[model samples]
Target: MAETIQLVFYIILFNFLLLVVTDVSAGGKMTQPKCHRNSDCPRNLCWPPLVAICDLHKCFCRPQHVNLVVRD
Candidate 1:
């Protein structure tokens, strides 16, 4: 019974670690708002590297790291 409980605990721990690894590995993807101001963002502010941008219609984070370029 003790062995079974230990195995179950390890399994749960491994799953949690795997989830954290997967989340950390997936970078450069952020959720932004479709508006112009910091109030539009979920955190009530936009991150420094990503600011608000509105193209007269929809708004999203303006990339601050790289230049405005469209990729294939």
Candidate 2:
């Protein structure tokens, strides 16, 4: 009975560690906001290297590259 309990505990721990590793490996992307317009997203909220863009009703920050590909 004690061995069975220990095995269950180890399984649970392994699952938890697996989830953490997956999250870390995925780079833990930042959460974006749902928006209908560009005005809904504010520039101040975006980080320095990233700019807020509203595309397909989602507002998220993307890397700034001379504003060539996408405009604000």
User: Top model by TM-score, which number?
Assistant: 2
Residue 35 C-alpha lDDT in model 2 = 71
Task: For each candidate, give its TM-score against the true structure.
Answer: 0.38, 0.41
User: 58, model 1: CA deviation in Å?
Assistant: 21
Model 2 scores what on Cα lDDT? 0.60
What is the Cα-based lDDT of residue 31 in candidate 1? 36
Model 1: which ten-residue window has the lowest total lDDT?
A: 22-31
**RMSD of each candidate?**
11.1, 10.8
Q: lDDT of candidate 1?
A: 0.48
Residue-level lDDT tens digits of model 1 in 1-72: 999999999999997875554334323233334655434444423455454444433334554453343221
- lDDT per residue as tens, model 2, 1-72: 999999999999997875554344324444356776656766664655656666777665555563333424
Best by lDDT: 2
Error of 2 at 47 (Å): 0.9
Over 4 Å off, model 1: 28-72
